[model samples]
Target: MSAMYGHRAKRFPKLPEHRRDQQIPDAFRTTMAGEYFMLGQSASRHILVLATSSNIRLMATRRTWALDGTFKIVPQWYQQLFTIHAFAAGKLLPLVYCLCTDKDIGTYGFKSQALIIRAAALEVDLNPDTNICDFETALIPAIQGYFPNARAVHRIAGELGLKTRYRQHEETRRKIRMLLATAFLPVPHVNTGVSLLEAGTTGTLAALFQYFRQEWMTDERLPLWNVHNIRTNNHLEGWHNRLNRKAGKSHNGLYELLQLLIAEQGVMDTLIQQVLSGNAAVGDLRRVNKVYAQKQRQVARYTGEYTNVRRTLKQFLEALIRVRAAMYGHRAKRFPRLSEHRHDLVLADQFKTTKSGEDFLLCQSNCRHILVFATGTNIRLLAACRTWGMDGTFKIVPQWYQQLFTIHAFVAGKLVPAVYCLCTGKDIGTYGYIFQALIDKAAVLEVDLNPDTIICDFETALIPAIRGYFPNTRVQGCYFHFCQAVHRKVGELGLKTRYRQHEETRRKIRMLLATAFLPVPHVNTGVSLLEAGTTGTLAALFQYFRQEWMTDERLPLWNVHSVNIRTNNHLEGWHNRLNRKAGKCHNGFYEQFHILIAEQGVMDTLIQQVLSGNVTVGDLRRVNRVYAQKQRRVAQYTGEYTNGRRTLEQFLAALMYLTPEPI
Candidate 1:
């Protein structure tokens, strides 16, 4: 606080109560404008005046009067010590000094008389252009009555010093603060901000609403605080503060004040020299600048839901910090303890229970930065399924995490999402950690977590990790993913335009793309694009096929005819829906937890519909009847029951046994 005030008062006026005012009438007798004290003559009060000199008053080129009143340094007989300063050369210098005995409306009427007498004594007209003050109700009317042409401008127009007598709850108080801050904004935005506050408020806030409307947003107060280029009253406040320290507090005696006035003559000489030498004293705005910068930073940090609430909370907490620091021995400057992200507050709690009253967050590893969310029911469904489908989406994933990965399985022939995890890496090791954790947790529920077949996209990292982690499960790469990989290669080799120009070329290229459906033994031969054409895309497609697809042992996984499902479309559909629900943009770390809990709600609903006995996949099963029959016949013809390879004659005979008449 001391540093914030800049220059301090070094000189003190050695004065006591009655002597300060009693000797004032005699003290100014030899000055440029003689002193006058009239008691009970002006009204029902005493008036003492030591007005500015005629020459100084005549120097008022700009007719702006800055008036203020203080009471602590006045004599016991006086009620208030008033000073009127005139603005000249961009500075406010004292023009008139008066001490009044009462605070009545009639007493203030006498202030007008004193100013009129001073103006007439200086041979200058009393009409002024503008009057600047702290907007004291009594003094304003008196200043206006005295100088009717002077436009009153109140410099105390900001929300910093607002005092409310009404009691309010915490949330209500915050709303009030925000509404009041609009006073410092541009005129157009002030009304809009107030209206937003009013729309969101009710009950006791209406009282606050009325208070703001009457006091802050009033027609007279608007221009003073608006971007109307009005100057602040810091200059007047600084002068009053310096005056208090020099007078040394309490009531002053006449003889002590006479000596003080004699000292003030020397003080004015030094001040006048400093001002004329282009070295006028300015108040310290460092503290004010820091606070305003902090406010702008907070505005940049929050948006939509947290913007207003975060501002209110940060201010309240900062005040609490100062109060606590002052009470204890801690430093007052060390305000607001920093912590993790704000949304972490709720996410840490969500680890206990979800919105649907279920244990939501199963496990979180801070070191690995992996979060795994799965309800017990979803785990059970995953354990019961013989086959699983997996997919990952980068779009809807939280900003804290890289991607959203989920495992889904067919339940009653309708695919249902079971487990979701947010892992730190797309590497094989990260996927290994995630799967190992899932396997351990599922074991606790007395369920076998391994699936017979795991269907997924052809992410190179994913395939190897699934094979390494779950050795027994057969990993089947999705047929659509396989085609997508080849499609990308076609574009890379610049064959897409040629493929599109000729429909026959397009058809042959797609057939080669669909070679993932052929059995591994014939997969290469089935994609022979040269048989269809010898030019353009056909020749390039075969070269890419032999170099990229044929060299991998995972070729068998892309054999769509051997898998229970040819594509992981269910998982992709789920990703699309989640991306839409979670919105287009990314989310925060804890925001993902909230979204996962929402996905938990989705699983909860899917489970309910599955058990409700109303929903069924009967039609879907019937549609796949012929495909199922074909799968069984192919299994027999392939001779999976015996280790020895079957002869072509024996395999055809076995295939004929399962191939009954079509009727």
Candidate 2:
């Protein structure tokens, strides 16, 4: 029997099927099943008590059970018992062949039924009386029975006087360990420098000495050149370990797994594209030449005049190729393979519209120049201009490198240009790279750098380039650039005073500048000027040029007659107008550079009309006044100027008459 316990407790709880919910005496219900608390317990917890209360309940109604060659049919409560009986019987087959027949005190009685079931699942058995260890402890040895042939055959061969293969297996393991250790050692040094040796023998010591001596003898200035090399096997092992952790345990192989890793970290190709878009250098070739010059300066011995350094120069050229491949094609490995999607792609023939309504296309004909203009906008489209100083422009490199250095002028958080130079064959020398075929063909041409006038807001690099190329040109700093520089200087001085208070201080500085000889000691103190003839020098000149005429009395503001008078507010207002017209996100530097030129062209015409005193507010107000319901703000702000023929004495007398001295 299956160790039946508390028979009286099981038997005395029986109740007729129809009397399941009958109200019985409290004492009888509480005392039923030999437990006094049965009556107080909730119905859910009292299920086991109720099941034992009646035999008909155990055999109750039709409960669905389907057997498809898996197990014997049994009552719901007895199914587990039946399965245990079957398993126990199978394990003890060599010991017993008889099947249990009696229903009472029967059904595989005296068996450790739970143990038998577990043993069968694990494919192992233990004595019923002996307490077996837990599943975790016994699982490995128990599972070994499932593949019994491998174990049993080995045992049989050992008993039958046949030698075991254990020694041979150990030898194989030793060979594998030796191979791995050897592979872990450093390989022959490919490129010579500081290197880790597999064996620190006399040969390695001599080789290191030779390498240093060779470098010292060849390039005497740079004696200690540091070089490092990582073995491929070790590098690969580390990479694989990192990849496994990134992928987790779910990923099975490298093919799909690498894609996930690439996606997470971002593909080199996508990063290269991002860098290209921001780079103003990618389309300019002169920049590449400058880079070559810089490299030549650094390793002068390696790059001597033409012949002596030919091989070294070729090596450097190869390095440049590697850099360009990584930047343009996302090729890091020597054997570069582009995706089918990339290979199948065709160059986009369509043009992108810029903020100023100019159509822009990539200029592939010449990488050195960027073209910007609008069609039929002016006599000849004024081109946008910016130049790169290295191969990064023409040869191609990481887009990030380009983005870091590319200059874009923004006003009121919008893109703008300080100036646009319209160039032709007559001004080719003044406008660099305009002769290039792509710029010539472009509806809007872009001049790399203009020599005629140096803009105030020109890039730091462009400043020197302009000075070098156009020695005699009037390099005017834009009024905006001058103001910014002043503000920066003021901030550096820790002057916390507001701009209003600073106005007088600024005017005194500005007026002192107008006088050829500066009498202000404070302004000249610790200041340096290139030419002594100029009062305060270029620095003061730059400050005075940026004067805003609306409120500043320092310098005479822009007058129609003045050829090149400047106002900082003019460029600010002009940039604001362009941004208000086109406020969409900029797609790329090249496109924005072009749009700025087109906007400048329209603005130039407007400025010309205002300068000529011909711009009228009536026409603009008449059109938009209905909806806007307001007059147009004056298109221009001018100082009070009467046709002056009076002498300073007459002006002083009039001023004196208006207000006599306070005393």
Candidate 3:
């Protein structure tokens, strides 16, 4: 009793004469003595058993120690302490200060405060500055100094390197501490003080993380410098918590925690392997199913139909019951029913057959129009190919295009988009009018554009009328028309040879421009190739080109101009996504098609940004710069120009002019 509070004031006294007549029974006292001795023996024996474990010994010797807290005394004890402290000190300290300084007081705060005020008050006041220094310099040590029993116990523990024993009922508390520490390794250890440890259970992992950075590791260099070292091996925690909570009445909680940790690790390893095998979504689904199975077994006692409340039990219990059912339940429902197939739909959707007869869902394709729809990030290609010829009835609607544009507002900090139209087998004029209606609707919606922007389409004669209405716009002939004109002008064989020559010229252009970054001497071979107008397919392709193509400043634009402006690959890609929903059975999209396409564009844009690494890709940064630069160089044409010089300030001004306003 004295050890509990550290002040030796009152002791139990002998009974008075009248009470002596009603003497205490020897049998009752003996029974009480035996029970108390047995309780003490059990506690000591349990501690000894922990000490005997090799794992415990090894952990104790290590410098690292995981700390946690458990409530020890009841609320009545709290009330008693408050009354006693108030009686001695005349009043409780201001509640705000009491709350604020409460954390600073560690274990045995009552004993420490009592001794400091009574026994050590004179020594402390004799030299206020020195005592304050002692108080501040070693607050934790001073608290321990006031209680001889606690100090002795802690000294023995520190000397022997004894790992503190956790309360039997508080294993969850200890595990939480260990899990948090492991997740944030190489970070300075968390305080593990009573308040912080208790806070971990209720707070989010992110909140605890911020707290660790701000409170525990107060060094200025903290968090920013040490962020990379923090390890988040939370897979075990996820599995353990699920399994522990799922443990049936038959199973011990401690054994379930350990067993589930082991099982969860195995399952995660398998799932990761499946993902690496190219079915990550499917693999995740499979793991989810397995967890459900385990939960079913754990909850088998409430065996009921899918429609029953038992079946509706949450995943934590459901997984345990399912696992047990799969393993040992004789009367439980067997394999998942056919209706379960709907649950697997999302996973099944992720799988596809490769061209080589392999079961791979994700494979790169050659057709750019269809390809961009799947991978999402092809705005530059979309814009360039808008003029290409598309034989199908698929079309681009203006209203939908504006909606798509609004969704993507920015791509890697640039504004680029594909044209939109309706598919029609009606004459070009009729199709053109349909596009006009969409444009009018877009205007009503107040869709913002460059005002100077020009949209060109297959309705060649209509371009001038559209441009007349929007004077800032200039309509360019579709590359699709130009490519078709070239074939009509030549023959099929000639068209094939011309295409091959075009590729060769592009390759030579790249080689010539390779060292241009350094401003070195030009290669004679490159110069010769540029000057010589040889009688081959390459020369024929460029034979009747505009004077703009001859200029140095416009040369880069020329390469893409033929592929995009001359052809309609850009518009065709949008048609393909819309057509995919309709398939060959339908000639054109119905009313729902417009909204679906618009919504799909939003999804694809987000996917593209993710793939391009404008945002961090799972902690990796700047992942797209090298790829973007390479693609830019490979896709463009280049030649030396006579008068293309502009100062950096002028360039910046021009860039600002070209940039889009924020939505």
Clashing pairs in 1: 16-252, 16-253, 17-252, 17-253, 19-253, 19-254, 20-253, 20-254
List model 3 lDDT by residue over 236-295, tens digit each: 223223332344222232222223323433443443333335454533343344554454
Clashes of 1: 8
Q: Show the lowest summed lDDT stretch of 10 residues, model 3.
A: 91-100
Q: Please give, for residues 424-508, the per-residue lDDT of candidate 1 as tens digits.
A: 6898877887788788878898888888999888887999999988899988888666766777777787876665466666655
- For residues 423-500, could you state the per-residue lDDT of candidate 2 as single tens digits? 212222323442233235433433332324333343344444445554554444453344444445544444324222
Instruction: Tell me each candidate's RMSD, in Å, in order.
Output: 33.5, 33.3, 31.9
**C-alpha lDDT values of all predictions:** 0.60, 0.28, 0.29
Report the number of backbone clashes for model 2.
17
Highest lDDT: which candidate?
A: 1
How far out, in Å, is residue 529 in model 1?
A: 7.2
Q: In candidate 2, which residue ranges exceed 4 Å CA deviation?
A: 1-347, 352-362, 365-379, 383-431, 434-458, 463-474, 496-507, 510-663
